[model samples]
Target: MSSSNEKRALSPDPAVAAPVGEVAVSVVEAPVAKKAKIEDDGKTGEEVQTETQEVKIDARDARDHGIARVKAEFRVPKSDYTVTDTVPSRDNDDESELNGREDTSRRQKRERGQNKNRKFGKAHDVIRLCEAIKDGGVCSHGDQCKYEHDLSKYIASKPEDLSGTCPVYEAIGYCPAGVKCRWMYSHWSKESNKSLVDEAKKAAAGREMNRIDRSEQLLLQRKKFPTPKSDLILPYLESVKEDNIARNGGNGGVPMTNEERADNAATYIEAPIKPGEKKRLNYSHAKILSPLTTVGNLPFRRLCREFGANVTYSEMALALPLLQGTKPEWALPRTHTDEIGGFGVQIAAPKPWQAIKATEALVEYCEVSAGGLSEINLNCGCPIDLVYRSGAGSALLDAQTKMLRMLKGMNAVSGEVPITVKLRMGTRDKTPIAKKLVQRLVREGDVAAITLHGRSRQQRYTRLADWQYISETAQIARDTFHEVEDKNKDGPERAPVWFIGNGDCYSWKDWWDAVDNYNVDSVMIARGALIKPWIFEEIDAKQYLDKTATERLEMIKRFAHLGLEHWGSDEYGINNCRRFLCEFLSFSCRYVPVGILETLPPRLQDRPEKWKGRNELETLLGSGDYRDWIKISEMVLGPCHENFEFQPKHKSNAYEQG
Candidate 1:
């Protein structure tokens, strides 16, 4: 090699450094050939060349750079094409232009001529009538000379007036005498003849016959009880799952343990109270709560479901939480397959967009695989100061039109889910308008079911639930819908929606009493389940078992296990579980009484005398201290001892709302 050529080969190489999390760069090269001693292009298509191309570096810092796409030509065989797609033609101008023009023309014509057709037609009809009166004034109003000669001016003045005017007499063309003349033209207005006859003929048409459209109308409105529809998910007694349970992870919707299915004869469900007997009113769905984010308290929710409590609602999830992808809050409506038998997720939003977004979020997450959400409940029941002031929750009753809009928004995105609603009676005047509010929801909102708490915002939970008024309201609701079917017979379709009663319900007797005496469809159980997780079992058992202290301890243990398995043993979750478990104990402890109240005041939740003493509560917990409640909570919830401590949820009202 020449000295000058050798000098060029010894220069240092320049290569970019590797990225933080990237593949190493490769120094690939082509074979080097001896120098070509030749012309630039006699043989253009074929050339012997060895080119040194720079490597394609994958430097992570390039992420901050802007991209500019440059076109490059390529000619490859058809087989080399990875994908082939047919392209649509871009030359359909006339079709698109004609469509746009037609739309614009239609709109302009509607604005300029369509709405004015009535006025224009009326003018033309009068002109024709005037001509008729001029040639032959057939008058039924041959009058007593005041404006006796002129009925035409009166007819023109009152367009729909049919009885007293001549169509031709502009002011009065004489003939002042009183008589029925063919020329005075008076008995009826000409415009009525022009349109009324046509309208009258249309009304004369009718259905060949009318029969009681049972499918079209629910019998509860005005007839007898409705026969149940087939194919509905059967409500099995809350059977135990000991045999079906696996030591393996994931429930897989298989909760029936082998022992449970086999022991079906072993009193799996307590017997139900017969209708018409004296019963507790505290077993109905009441104390409507917001489906607050993060699921309020899972340990409490599980306890309610495990005992076969009637109604369970999820925390009220915000519309924005789902739409904007906020963490955790977006997952508030999450539920399980076993829960769908009696589950409702109440969603809240101040706008139509939120309702749409929230309903979509529910559909995506609340599937059978994730959590089978049974009902999509709109949260129009919250009475909190902040929520009420925001024009959501109970405040929605004031704007029926807006309420309809939100319901429609939810329905649009709900897919196959039934849209249920939870609402307060009203902001005020609970009784009189109860019927009206229900009618509006039924007619305009198209709700599957409605759960009305018996108090208004003014009353809060301070006053007693006016049961008779709620009963009357529900009766009125039934009657009003009965009249609607009779009116809009051929307009559309309808469905039989269940009217669930809600309020202070805490015992088995309250449920049976509400159903038989007052005639309600179903009852919701809330604080009743909270105070006594096993209240459902006791209800099913016919007579109160008073649950031996040992049984109570067993439940506390199971609840703790479910809580830990769900919340995990992380620091945050352990503390959260502890706080909620304590809150639950504060409630459950209220159920274990030293003696039975031959006549307990309706709901046990209403009166905690059942388990009220510091010592009595301890005895109930199988111990004489509150700390035992935490220890029981811990045993089931896994080792949450060193990591977290339990906290109380209710105010120090001492004996107030548990």
Candidate 2:
């Protein structure tokens, strides 16, 4: 038989039955609730009681203990606990439990190293300029040089039948790849062992390909990019020196007095660009795409452009790496010829010096008219753990003073290029500080635009973004900008700083609602753009698009073609396209068929249950498995690498079962 103490131990709350001094331990279990039916009265909707069922307690020894005696005398009332059976249906209950709660611990770790494929063989093992037949110079190493000295030997080694024309040779006139390229036979002549017989010679005559002309190589060679007439470097350095003196003495190395501090402030020089001369970018009513970290490659942005995205941003590049002239980081700023007019390069920096120098280098290398860079945006909203740990990304939200300094320095050095900032609600959840931050940015940041993502760092993607707060903060931005305009009336005329809101804009309806209600200049989309690349088209039509599986497949094929063009049609480029395609599929597969949804304008957070598509193609397109995504990629780009392993960034409905 069980004692009273044993019965009390099962209760969720010990205060209900335990004496003042008695201690009780509770067993945690999934709560069960009695169902309630709603019977709408003609006058009012009300819940009418139908019948009461006996509570089923899973007490193992209830019969032996005669639980009826304990229940009759000292029953734990049902009123003590709130009912949780308000779930409308079992499907909804299941969806609510799974939505935004996916586990991605394994996938996150493997995400960084997945793009490790590189072409084999030494790229530099070719005939040098000094040894070239045209140069008419002999190699100092002679036979000891690793590269082929005889032009005849190099031509004889090439395959008799050529595959295709060398893309690099076709572009720049000379083939830097030289003997290493598989398609060397097509570019090189069968009769002549020289670099080219006709086409290559003509192209080479037009322009010479210098193998040592890489961006990083120039940095290592101590070459500086051209400086603007209105250089800010001197003023910035002087300001830093004055600040150091004010805080920690001038010649004596002691703290200065209040009068000395005032004198320093009075003597400080400002590096402000003349208002009429500063560059401007039009973001108003612009269909802008958010800068995706990995998936937002050049080909993908070009695809978005064709679909209707007007203003596009490059994937975020780190400032330190850009300053060091890293190859991969510099590649981030390279845009396709088609995107030249509307592209903006986004950069991440933790310090003012890093930001200013990186911006200056970018401006010099990629001019507004030539390099496709319309604006420079500072990324302050990245939430990845690595970025935050480096005192960059969302970590800047806590370091507002430093963020302002970085922005101002970047603006001063950018020269004819506008500066922008992307921010989040705040660092922590339920503690929104973007409203106040916007006011400060308007007053001192000198930014051309500000983008506020509606979610905090703590929220990640767990909950739906708070658009209401976004609208409120947007109003604050509008008022603050006006206030700044009034204060600057006596000074140089300034352009209106655009305020763009980003988050959870999945459908045309959501986009319209946000723009109409929030009063923001425009909206920037991230996941929604991936899920449905044609979202901009829908926004124009003001309706939901039900793109068929065949249409979607065609879009994927276009993406592959563009990838081949940008990355190359070679084996390495094909594999690179396949990898990025799979990363894109990680978000694309989450899209539920608009035809199957019972509700209009599907929500981003809604997790659909297991369901089959109308056809095999649709089923495959809607698949959440990374393997299925690979199969889809294979349909367009041939077989995958045997060693290639893919894990989706997020666990989708199909992977949930695993």
Candidate 3:
């Protein structure tokens, strides 16, 4: 009974017919005026027809009409849309429906944090060779050793040698990994089954510095390592604190008894060395690299050094672990020959005693090394929840007196190795306290240098760093230094404290601008260097170098090469290198090609819309996909082992399911 217009409305429109492979069919009844037919009684009648027609709705149109249509080629089935939740799978062919495609949708549930519980599988070798046996020494455990001792059996089951010269052997003239090296074919002699070594070259190679011997580590673990200076300084600091409290009318305003005064006087001891006597450092206009965690391993620091970073700090180490002589924590201070003159060790501690003991131990162990410690930096700026919750890192911002006490004790114990501190603007985003702290640091801290990151603990890389505030604090420090210098004119002259500013420094201009206009001695780069390792080179040249994709790949190859040299060429070492390499790539991928950018001097916060690169290699280098980073790693380190798995520390890189 429907009219012609109604039937036409229900029918598919030819103008908006669906494209190929996207048609939908529907059945409908319509009155079709068939030729008037004569019935048995000779009466004329019209016929009603039922027909099925393809709906022919465009996929785009269907989406507009609240229908989900996912393309086959753009599917990402295993995508993790939120930090804690995986994307739900679709039951039908519409599996490619983009999960959290809208910016708001993506941001609604996304949590900003690091990847948790990442799986880094152990060595692929079922029978790991014993180090003693591999070094041609008898195992301490003899026949009951858990590790494989038979060299022939290990070699028989070893994976095929990687196709390249052993980088470590080439650099140092000896392969420490020996039979276990993935590139063993390059350094091993099949005829004699002996590893080849260039004795002359080996003899000339400079040894890696800051290494603690096993006996020394054991001494520390047994609490037998001597900390004579810390032992004296800790009690002196405690007595000074108590005297200050008593002078301030604490303890019910009770005056010190003669016995108490005598006890305090006996405990008091002067520092063996003074701040004026410490080894002086010149940080003025230096291109420094920040002490990054996770990504700032030894190999990465070496890479940045090659790119012209003048000063580099070790990754932030925990003071308690260092005091305990844990191998992993002790390993952070190990330095390459190239890092000697400009290297610093950064550590975090919750209390003065811990910081003092840790500083004493590091100075005692590492001070005699070639070109000894440039400075020992106390890390008070780290904003991670783990460090903050432990009353360390940025937690010190809320407890200024405790931080100052710790720094003072650290200075007392750290012989000629001068102490420094890295700090944030404040614990909170709105209220900054560094300017006031600068005055106290000049008067009381006796720190050799100060580096202030312009962001607060609460901000946590969410906003642009307040350089104006950093500049204000730097001026305060400068003024305070002058005041201290005037007061100490008749006393032993101390070296001026260097002030370095850090944050959002991504280019040559950023570096020079802070030094020229912001009143900072220098700027320390973190994510900037990770994004472009050659940023220091740019600062020197004062111009941007549009590196070709091949050149970038060469840099990656150099990183892998250096990684193998530092980490070794064993299976475990290769995987370790791969994991860190991927971590580097996760940050590196944020870089947009200068050629593709519509403007000059790319901003670090500017996230470019999806765009193609000039070449496939360039595109791959700029891929957000972690798998592509793995592919890039394979290009340098050879095929990934079957057991190798990598999850990027950042959640942004997990968008691609693979």
For candidate 3, what is the TM-score?
Answer: 0.82
Candidate 3 lDDT tens digits, 1-658: 1111111111122243333333321213222324455666665443434344423322233223322222232222444232222332223213323443322244444434566767775566867888875534567998888889888899889888888799889988988888889988898877766678899989987666798999999998998989888888788777767776887898765667788888877776768789889888999889899999988988999999999999999999999999889999998998888788899999999888899999999998895446757889998899999999999999998888888989988898887888999999999988999999878988884799999999999999876889999999999999998988888789888788999999999877688889999999999999999999988887876555566687788899999988888888999899999989998998888776554443334555545545545667876898776667888999999998877877666654533212
Order the candidates by TM-score, highest first: 3, 2, 1
Question: What is candidate 1's lDDT per residue for 1-658, written digit by digit as tens?
Answer: 1111111111011243333332222222222323333445532232343334432322321211321111112112333322101111114434533543233323221111121121100111222222223323454545432232344553454323213332212112222211222222342235433211123433442111112233322432333322221101011211222222333334655555567556663542322211112111222333223243332455556566667655566778666655555555544655543354456678777765566556755665455233366567887777777778887787777766567666755554555566777777778864435568788777653577777777787676655576786787777666766777678788655555567777776666666567666646776655566666665654554334344455566777666545544553323344555656665676665563322222222344243221222233334363222345566665554443342433233212234211
lDDT of 3 at 308: 95
Q: Which candidate number maximizes TM-score?
A: 3
Give a tens-digit lDDT track for model 2, residues 325-372: 677887888776667667888998877677788888887777466646
Off by over 4 Å in 3: 1-113, 135-141, 249-267, 367-369, 654-658
TM-score of every candidate relative to the true structure: 0.51, 0.70, 0.82
After superposition, the stretches of candidate 2 with alpha carbons farther than 4 Å from their true spots are 1-216, 220-272, 641-647, 650-658
Q: Candidate 2 clash total?
A: 0
- Candidate 2: give the clashing pairs: none
The CA lDDT of each predicted structure is 0.47, 0.66, 0.78
TM-score of model number 2? 0.70
lDDT of 2: 0.66
The predicted structure with the larger TM-score, 1 or 2, is 2
